[model samples]
Target: MRTLRKYAGPLSDRRFRLLWAGQGVSTAGDAAMLVALSLALVSSTGSASALGFVLAATAVPRLLLTLVGGVWADRLPRQKVMLAADAVNLVAQVGIGVELLGTVDVGLVAVYAAASGAAAAFFVPASGAIVPSTVAPEHLARANALVALTRQIAMVAGPALATALVVTIGAPWVFFLNAGTFAVSAVTLALLRVPAVAAVRTGFWDELRQGWREFSGRRWFWTNATAHICWNLGRSAYQVLGPLVAVRQLGGELSWGLIAQGAAIGAVGGAVVALHVRPRRPLVVANLALALGAVPLVLLAVAAAPVVIALAAGVMHAGLSVMQVIWQTTVQNHVPEHALSRVLAYDWLGSLALAPLGLALAGPLADRIGLPATLAGAAVLLAGGCLLVLAVPEVRRIGSRPHQDLPTAEE
Candidate 1:
């Protein structure tokens, strides 16, 4: 009880609490948008290929602009960036919602999605870099855990709300709700009061180069990211192809959402556990958890029992969330705050570079090799990628060091 009390006080910080609330709302909105968008694509075209293009449009921006976003994150005030980005997002969502009311043009939706996604590309790195500024070093794990929990809750609520809206009101309203969420988030963010770190006077390109230097110079940074590129590629295959498999091969959207929900539930628990227990070798723990995700992919492909597949998926998601919390903490701790955004941008670029390729190829690959065979192949690839990291000495041996350069907080 004493230990628990000692560890549990991070959530009481006022700045973090406001940030957390805003982020929670934004996450829910994003989730709702995802649900509405997916349903819109499926209902309008009834083609997996169409959905793939939409997904690609939404994602490819991050792969392209992540570095630029990072460069700016290093040079500018993170809080201001967040505030401006959310305001931009609010307008974009409203415009899209209004457009959707007139036509079912998927292309128009794609264009709006691309614009919003480009804005999102900048938002992520800045948000990630700013988080450490709001809390003490000892409280990082708890902070990250709270963030993950909010994300999970938002995801669960968002999809459910989207479903109800789609049934009751329509798809256009979902976008309106998304706009409202960003409005609320932006207002809350504007209310936050923290001492601003002055922006450094660095040219964009030079700052970008410096961020790259920091990213590539570290063995642990590149090694883990490289492994994650492979992992995310496979995971992307699941994201794009999984629903198609469920809808066409299994049942329909409801079944697919259920499968996703199972994973989300597991992830919530995983985040909590990660917050409570700080692993020595966070990379090792993260890699092991990532490897475990392959179990469900293989199980779903081979096993005919639906319950078995669902159980495997739940375990996979739970493990993945644990891996994410550890990964976030390690990156934030080791990277300098001034350059953290750009480094994170590089991290996002490297990790997600192949996601579009995976999405593009999954359908065709499944067509040629068969769904079960393709899933089995993905499982093999996921395991192989994880094993590659284990072979690297830095990753295998790396552990959490004490906050030697930073001060610890009192509870």
Candidate 2:
């Protein structure tokens, strides 16, 4: 209990409090949308392959624009950029909600999906860049833990709320709620009293180069991120393959939802553990947990027992959440605050670049290799990729030392 208290640092800091509240609300709303979207698509298409396309659409734009967003984040004030991102999301959500008020077209839904995804590409980089500014270095792990807690709470609450909305109100209302959440977040950010951004005047090409230099120069940064690329590749496969398998081969959408919920609950526990328990080799811990995330895939594919599959998947998501908290803290501590967004953007691109490819191929691969076999293959790939991380010496032995003295912007 004392250890857990360490992770709940005083959010009484005005900046952190405002930011946390805004993010918590926005994330919960986003979760509602996620659940609503899943049901909406399932109702419309009745095919997991089509659902995969929606996920791919969301990821591909992030892959393409992530670096650009990062550059923008570095060049401009992160708070303002976040404000704009939130506004953009608000508009996108409103548009979707309004459109859905009339009819439920798959084409329109896909368009809304792409637009929302593009908005997210901007939002995520900005959020990542801004966090280090909001809290002190010593408090970063706690902040990350708090954010993870917010995310988990959102996950648990969002779906059930979405389910209720869909059953009683409708999917469009979920979008409306999401839009309102973003609006509230934007307003809260506008009220923050942060210091002016440090002027780093550089040309577009030069800024890109500088950002790239910062990103690639850190050995630990690139290696850990590279490992994540493989991890996400396998993850993308699991995202598409797992639910589909549960529905078509095993049970139905309800069963798949249960499986997903189980993972979410386990992830909440993982976040709690990561926050209080500081490992010496934090990066290595994160990498290994993420890589071993593939273990669930083996159970999912090979096992006929539903209980076994659910338990394995729950364990996998638990590890995933812990890795996320560790990685966020590492980035916040290691990278300069001014260039954090650029680095984060590159991080996003590197980690998720293969997601579209994975999603794009999963359907066809499942058809050819059989769903169980393809899932088993993804598990094998994940395990091998995790083991491959041992080759990166920095990953194995880094994050055990103190942070470098980098010039950080004030929040």
What lDDT does model 2 reach? Answer: 0.78
lDDT (tens digit, per residue) of candidate 1 on 1-411: 877756566667878887888989988989998888788678767887777777778777766887877777777777777888888788878876886687567777677777787788888998887778788878877888889878977876788899999889988899899999998889878887766666676677778887888887777778788878877777766776678777776677776777777787887777777777688878888889888888877766764455566677788888888888888888888766777898889988876777668877887998999888888888878877877888877676666663322211110
What tens digits encode model 2's per-residue C-alpha lDDT throughout 1-411?
Answer: 765555667374678888889999999999999888788777756877767777667666767787788888787887788889888889878877886677566666667677777777777888876776777667777787888888998988888899999889988888999999999899889987666667486887788778888878877777677777777777777899888877777777777777777788788888877777578888778867776588778867864556666677778888888889888887877777778788888888876767668878888998998988888888877767667776777666666333652332221
Full-model lDDT for every candidate: 0.78, 0.78
Question: Model 2: how far is 21 from its true place, Å?
Answer: 0.6
Off by over 4 Å in 2: 1-5, 38-60, 104-113, 197-199, 243-258, 366-373, 400-402, 405-411
